[model samples]
Target: MRDGTDHGDQMSDVKKGLLPGQLIWLWLTGVVIALDQITKHMVVARFDLYERLEVMPFFNLTLAYNPGAAFSFLADAGGWQRWFFTAIALGASVVILIWLARLTAAEKLQGVALALILGGALGNFYDRLVLGHVVDFLDFYWGNSHFPAFNIADTAITIGAGLILLDMFLGAGNGAEKKEARKKHD
Candidate 1:
């Protein structure tokens, strides 16, 4: 049999410039955005503003809009919030794209976080640009207590942020991994 050089050359041929593993995260991002928009479209078609359809004891489908940040922060502030939030989301999307391009194949956790964030940002950005507000439909409640209505985009962002926090707390970054390796070696 030949030496390992054959395998190295084959790998180099397969990985011209872009890595397949890196692009997989971008595909997941696309799926997230597609799901977010499709669900939002369904909500808009089936529900009117403030209209609620109880889906379960603790959940409902409600159509609502927010022209501001998370939990409707600055939602009441004049129309400037729309542009402000859009700009933020756009900037975030660009940053996430660059970040994703830089991630290595093994940084799956970070990749997932960035993709989720990018997908969510694009989803909301689309609404803000075309509708002047973010469409929210998912409603969770118990008795009289209720959580704010949110859409898939919001869910993605929240989950992405949570994953980022989890990564930080777990010390899964490159520095931490290297530290662990050194400790094991010593």
Candidate 2:
């Protein structure tokens, strides 16, 4: 019942594949990585290792390093945490890449989140491998309460994490995706 043109069209669609169209998300990842690295590089060039510049009443740009995990956890453990954190980030990067490969382009929520997390992971990984620590420059504080300094990579990672949570709770990314998944279960 199909003509030669119809068959050709079908073949073309099949040949287009799933991963090629997903390159946009990869480019988004590249942009995040570039911004994170550029901002950190500018901060390092302008500020001393521990110098702080008050950017506003509630914010400050400070040059600090975290040799450990978030909020300086285990930051004083000498040097072992460096390798430990590095390994974790690398493992996460691999997992995100695998997830992205499997995800469809229509899954924008998860796609964007995965891309952002990928960029953040690579940005921090670069810092860990080269500088032996992650850079921290964005500092926030209240009248007397202060928050730990974090970097652009940390910011992206946080946003990505939030998006992932939103997607999971809202059944977003693709409505039909959830429906099909539920149907498979039933």
Candidate 3:
């Protein structure tokens, strides 16, 4: 109804793969994956492992491989962690897809957030499945202290997580307002 369309029409579009439902947000997911993979490929071709090209006072285009989770967690835990993370990413992608498909049209923010997270997860999952590690290139540092290197996928995931938190807080406020309005009506 947001666009003068009914839920039946939305469902028809979904069935036709026209991407008119909340699944329309999957277009963002595809864009993120394409950008993430393209950038990672460019970095891999242009730099050697651990190579750093300073771009600014606090940023660099560096080449890094992470065999573990965020911040290189379990990076040194032999080789099993690679598959473990891959499996998790695969499972999460499936769950996100289903969740995105089930979202009401009103849940636009949540849909976008889930799509971003799904795209990021699949992008990293591809690297883990094929390369045994995730390629990370963007680096940020302050003087001698450097943050962990990450890639476009990580950026998307982080942004998506922030959006979800925002939606949660906003939804809470709206719910409270609705409750107050109901009390006044009663």
Candidate 4:
């Protein structure tokens, strides 16, 4: 006994409170948050602001702070950026959680990507909320040019973004295209 209506009902139930979909990936989010905080705390404890310890020819552990977005985009914007960025992170986190809960089982890659981004957003959100700035310690550079110092949260966010791009090209998008082709044939 099968009915087409049952699938729609199941989807509605999942969308409602009756089912928790793909939230299994939340453990990854927690792990990313924990690691991000721990590393930031360690950098704060071991290094003075602007102090640098050479770890390699092109890499160093440098204590730095950013009160702005990536690359210190608004580091000197008269301090409103902190609250603004924090608000964005909070909103993004909420949206990511809802998106995670609504994901289908087949969207495992998307689930992981969203979880990493959520974790990174919250990790930085904690800093902006409590410290008013993010602690950055990992630095890379060439002979005279130094890249912006960043942290575990930034790294996770970057990797998550890359995964999202990869999925767009190789994952569900392709499956949808295949499904569309099948529909055309039928």
Candidate 5:
């Protein structure tokens, strides 16, 4: 019961496929990368390597470099960890970029979230590789206790992870195949 005209039209649509949401996601990834780099550059230029500028009752702009992973894991490992971490990050970024290019337009939020994480990961990855450490600023404290200092890239990764978790829970119904599965499960 298929017509030649319908088949040709369907093929043409596939060839020209792209939704607005996809464009937004791509743009979001770029924005996160640019913001992360710009802020890091500002922090590096304005602040001495490890100088602190007390800003408020419980916050400061302190320049510090992390030699290891979160909370400075293996930071005192005599510096071998830096190269290892950088290699891991570079590998992960490569995989993520490839994934982003292959994603369809309808999977906007998911793609965007992934892109943000990827960008942030690469941003830190670059620092860790080139500087042998990741920069830390934006210090917060509760009396003597302090939360770890972090940057915009870290924020983007955290937010992206949260959005991805939300998307999975809310059933975004991004693609025809996914929608069918969701409907079946529901």
Candidate 6:
């Protein structure tokens, strides 16, 4: 009934349809994609493919390109798989961005997770479609055991995946709506 209260409710209703934070999330996601691509470009230009530069006892920066999925799986499939992977990434990115656009700004962590995934997906998709492979550089190992060379994009995607999993397990009841519903019932 009050003026300020009505305005606040209107703002809340507007946010329920399309939150401002989602745009911020989109921008951040674009930044991540840019950073990932630029870093990969630098690595490709600076180092020869598969050239390892040991920076730490267990860490190495190198240039490696993978045509397939994680741990180089299906990398030797006669090169037709690059386009396949690119299509998959592009499709996934579309779905993620659409979902992000519909999500509320208050779902910060979930939005962040989705944005990271979107950026990472597009980053790798760019590489696969443009260069026919995904450029990787960060490497870690302990003697004979190696943990596979990966890049910033891959790391972001991995973290995003973890966050998605965490949200699935924790976000359900802990979400704002559920809390509000509980309060109303109480």
What order do you get sorting by lDDT, best first?
Answer: 3, 4, 2, 1, 6, 5
TM-score of each: 0.82, 0.83, 0.84, 0.83, 0.76, 0.82
Instruction: Write model 2 residue lDDT over 24-134, tens digit each, in one string.
Output: 778988999999999999999999988989889999999999998899999999999999999999999877876666555556798899889999999999999999999
For model 6, what is the error of residue 14's alpha carbon versus the real structure, in angstroms, after optimal superposition?
A: 14
Among residues 3 or more apart in sequence or in different chains, the pairs in candidate 1 whose N, CA or C atoms overlap within 3 Å are none
Error of 1 at 98 (Å): 1.3
Displacement of the residue 123 alpha carbon in candidate 1, Å: 0.2
Residues 59-115 of candidate 3 have per-residue lDDT tens digits of: 999999999999999999999999999999999987787566656666778888988
Candidate 5 clash pair list: none
Question: Candidate 1's residue-wise lDDT over 1-186, tens digit each?
Answer: 165466554444335413675788778889999999999999899888999998899999999999888889999999999999999999988778766665555567878998898899999999999999999999998899999889898888889999989877776446866566435522
Q: Output the TM-score of candidate 6.
A: 0.82
- Which residue runs of candidate 1 sit more than 4 Å off their true CA positions? 1-19, 172-186
Best by lDDT: 3
Please give the lDDT score at residue 18 for candidate 5.
28
In candidate 4, what are the lDDT values of residues 73-114, reduced to their tens digit?
999999999999999999998778766666666667877898
- Predicted structure 4, TM vs. truth: 0.83
lDDT of 4 at 52: 94
3 or 6, which is superior by lDDT? 3
**Per-model lDDT:** 0.83, 0.83, 0.87, 0.84, 0.75, 0.81
lDDT of 5 by residue, 87-181 (tens): 88889876665555545554566787887888788778878877889888979999999898888778888888897898787654545666664
